[model samples]
Target: MTTNLTQHFLLDPEVVFLNHGSFGACPRPVFEDYQRWQLKLERQPVEFLDSRRGLAANLRVARTALAAELGTDADSLAQVTNATTGLNIALQSLPLKPGDEILTTNHEYSALEKTLLFIARRTGAKIVTVEIALPLNSAEAFHDAVLAGFTDRTRLLFLSHITSPTALLFPIERLVAEARQRGIWSVIDGAHTPGHIPLDLDALGADFYSGNCHKWLMSPKGSAFLHVRPEWQAMIDPLVISHGWTADNKEPGVRGPFGASAFVDEVEMQGTRDPSPWLAVPSALAFRRDHDWWQVAAECSRLAQETAARVRDLFGLPALSAPSLSAPQMVAMPIPPCDPIAVHDALLRDYGIEIPVFEWQGHHIARLSCQGYNTREQMDLLVKALGELLGLEQPRRKLGQA
Candidate 1:
């Protein structure tokens, strides 16, 4: 709030936008860079799309920049449109037979839950969902709960790096390591991890990790990456065949026609779609670096946690987990039992505050996302609106007004 970073974002001034976790609002500089890439592509459509020209090289430059930040080499990653796409590419490529198990948690994003269900229906792989207890006090508790579900038939381990429904940061490093030791393929859905947390994919040692650059990174929408370990890259297949396909693409050390590894080429080059969002990733990284985003993120985390606590206390609900276990910028504050749809609509319609209010696991939750552009005043407005709309009795002075 003190830094006054709101001016850099492209959000509408009238509405209080607290839903950065849903689909991120791109910064002005990053948006401009995205437009520039789009314009360049429009000007020379064939040249820009053609790998023989400079498409592959330009994408490599972007990937290398992102890889350096993610603590991995360029060849190990493939730029995808979004995390779901990247996840699907990884999920579909795995060879799951009938009765094989995919171990996950109940806190996964809904789309991915459906994706797993789809994969399960096709391959007859049983999706084993572990229910993590609320008010998580320790990382070891979470680790134990997830690992307990693993069995000899467990062929894959899939879970969110930062859960979408509950917004709790799962202790995945230990689980990933355990899964690897058990010969279980680890596929992580890191949709909210790229800029929200410090990420070192190699050090984490997951066999496959996919994350969105658009969510916490504040890049243009449709920018994300799927990282595969070099040994597993040969088994991973692209979602679409397109021009990048070659006969020996599944074979290791095979280079695509574009000169990069077959994994990068087949996965990245999915035909004539706009690559502007992926290309603009470097600008997003530079914006964060120049703006001292880590300090900003720390401040935002404070604001988000404080706001969540205030809301929870007002509603007389317990905290979801320890502060350290929650995401730095996003928190799912528990609300009193109510119709989530009505509350979500009323907040937007009457209060002009934009935030996600939904029901998860039979509990109503208002998931608040704190970005650099958000203010304490906006949070106050949200709290005030919730109290009034939920019919909570306020003190004599009322809330958010003198």
Candidate 2:
């Protein structure tokens, strides 16, 4: 923590950026590499963007690096703009009929909730949402809550690896396995999980998983990957029809013009787009390796937990979960009754802290994110700012107290 890791990032020095869980801050080296890729593309547009030329081969190299980090085969992964797009591709492709059920939970990201609603309206499929109880203490509690939602009509199960609103980590391994046993397809939204936690997608056994490198991996924005098991890859259709897509895509082992499986080629080869962020992924991985980011992330998790506890005591608020059940580097603390927008604006205006304040399940939440660049002093600053803004002149009840 004494090494001043902030110097390596491109964030503004004036802002105490506690919003890494939102669009992440790219490190200097990775941003430079992203610019380098952009320069290369501009130098020769035809050679860089043409699938028959350097484009396809270059994309494969990036995918290989990401696949190794994700513990999946390169061919099973496809580069997309973000996890939302990836999940859209996976969800819309499913052959949902009238009366089929798409099972999910209450804590899913709002954008995805809209996506699910759209799909349900169009396909006449019903969305069965289960409520995950708060103050989570054990994995069994999560498993029990989710497993009870499954029914014979359930065809697809969608879940967030780390929830957005409450910032709690759902123990999805058991639920995914149970879904598989029930012959239900499992799709995971891993937007906050790529570098925040250790992942082994093949071992996880989810039918489809999508994550954002731009969030936790510290890559440039608009970089993410979707992984599909080989058996299910043929069923995935690209969001856009492009040259790489073929009508005979249902035939297995069919390689596109890029020499990768039809699944990867179709999802990745959309119309002209900047591939710089995707190509810069290897540099982001390298940066993490060189910095020993695992150790830094551990420190960050400790800081996040300690800070959340302090905030909880300040507001007399109960915890959403135990430390083990929460996100490693992001903690959403329940704040005293207040307008979320006013608190959010006051923090930025009165203090230079950048954080997210919103309502979840009728409770106002102040979500804090800790990255390698954050310091103990910054966390203290945030606590001081909140106390003053909310008029918490005296500490309230302790975290576990009723």
Candidate 3:
């Protein structure tokens, strides 16, 4: 509740950052840790660059810590720059044939949607976007709608664990199980799941999953990961071809002198890049633990519920997801009829509130994310601003109104 604790972030103090779900704000301590790694790299470029051992070792440490947090083995997981890159790798690596179908929800992120479209066009595969109703009434309804999208010809099911535009957490556990039963591959875009919800990759049971640490985990930007089941590993080809493609007659699994297998040699050695963000993941984890993020999340959930109630009361709109179905930490509320862009811009320019507003299936949503730093006063300001701007109470003076 105190600005003292919140001031450690480099976020603009004048703005109320309600959009942590988009890209997370890194803490000062974590930022310092990231810089330390950068400094270390600069101090010994020859020792670090000439030897793959140092980079691999650091990666192994990061992988172990991340795997423990995600409840998966380190061997099946590797760090990537972000979830988008991971999704691209997954889509491009999959062996799709003509007439195959990739079923997804209409609520998917636009970037990943474009990637799927590109794959469909190149491989003659079909991308079927099933409409999942907004102002969702119950968990059963959501599950039924998603399951209805499956078909005999469906080769893959691509879905967002937490949808970007909608900001609703999909019931992926049941879907993953059903997809497995149908012998269909499940590739989940978990970009928003890692820090917001509990994730056990082994227990979640997906063929491929990718998440961004930069968003919720409070890691520096460009920190993300990709997890692939061992069976599908053979089919994956790195997007880049470098030392990983063909090393000079080296034994398998061994980090060959300089260059290696396409998986490790190419992707791992993208060449003279900043590994600071990835290396600072452990520090981010420590920061979360030190701050008691679990309790912080619980508090945020309470605040989110309160904020949602207030917004719904002001607008007379329905809730997007059932209280039990959605993560308590984040809420996507239905906004009364308005231009999403206009409302979004008004909130920022007039009220100094930062949030995401978008139209989903004929309903406009003002998705509000509650992080530890946010206070009830900020939510109240948002409500007041929204009421005045939308003429919910009375016709307030417009921007240019006399």
Candidate 4:
């Protein structure tokens, strides 16, 4: 059933689209809904943008629905273009002093690493990274690995809920608790968590968390949210100074610390932009809900597990991070010694397979993702392609079919 779901997506029919981890493909219905909001905006620009109450109400509805799913309140959230922007706001907003260290993992997204580096260089703070061992067995090992890097200079602990390069789900809950006990700010880059996995943001209890709706949530591009805890919300500054910026914290008395009105006024009241994608969040949620997304994601996760096993067996390489419990729907495996760019070119040129193959930690890593639209046959083809490229006979591993 999930394999048949390809008809709903606008992906190229000829290519085996396995790189859902990169830029996610939006389903037709959700894309239509995104366009509908854009059309509505175009119909009456002034009236739509000036209607503060109407816009706020629309955002409230969308955030309320999303918050219910994410296990957080609408008051704690603000819309952003993507997780990168949200993280930029968070990293820039915090009032860090010189010599304050922001600790993170080596598995972080490269873009985020650059952002943090810039912040550190600008503010005299330091970016400290800890290494996570491959073939990870348990969450405890991950937590221990990060905790081992903790020191007195570490003011904040930054990490991904689901890492980008390696595709491992960290033990964030325990890490957050550990950070809290040590008076460290816990910031999570949750760009891949919302729709792929079950998220309980309130229970997770991180000081700050940002994620992309455009990725796992299957929303149109440019839809994401930044969630700040009560204590940290007042400190958050908008990346751009606009109408929302004022001498006074507007409506601070009525709107608690980070309630929807205050948070929106501070972070969301930026000058001008198409707010359509964020408004279309409900449509994206509905698209998945109508399709029994939980079961679909579960089915895809099984295929992802099988794909990882197949790739590892084909390459004679160990899994990068996933071992006991496989990454849900996305996995990164190490390939044999080869030029990553050449392999990337060959995969796209010879094979009509769209996947990410890159260098990480001096190893050529290829991350494979299986969405609801992906099929087992496509995964088999990927295995065959890898075997032929690497000059090995494809060994049929005793893998359980998803």
- Native-vs-model 1 lDDT? 0.91
Clashes (candidate 4): 0
Per-residue lDDT of candidate 1, residues 70-169 (tens digit):
9998989899989999999999999999999999998999999999999999999999999999989799899999989999999999989999999999
Candidates in order, TM-scores: namely 0.96, 0.96, 0.92, 0.93
> What is candidate 4's TM-score against the reference?
0.93
Error of model 1, residue 56, in angstroms: 0.8
Q: How high is the CA lDDT of each candidate model?
A: 0.91, 0.91, 0.81, 0.83
Of candidate 2, the 10-residue stretch with the lowest lDDT total is: 393-402
Give candidates' CA RMSD values in order.
3.0, 3.7, 2.7, 4.5
lDDT of 4 by residue, 237-305 (tens): 888888666555543333522335565567887878888999989998999889989899989988888
Model 2 misplaced regions, further than 4 Å: 249-252, 392-402
Give the Å error, residue 138, model 4. Answer: 2.3
Query: Global lDDT for candidate 3?
Result: 0.81
Residues 1-402, model 2: lDDT tens digits: 444599899899989999999999999999999999999999998889997888898999999999999888999999999999999999999999899999999999999999999999999999999998888889999889888998899999999999999899999999899999999999999999999999999999999999999999999999999999899988999989997787776445778767888899899888899999999999999999999999999889998999999998887889999898999999999888777777787788768889999988887899999999999999999998888777544322211112
Clashing pairs in 3: 243-260, 244-260, 244-261, 244-262, 244-265, 244-266
| Per-candidate total of colliding backbone pairs | 0, 0, 6, 0
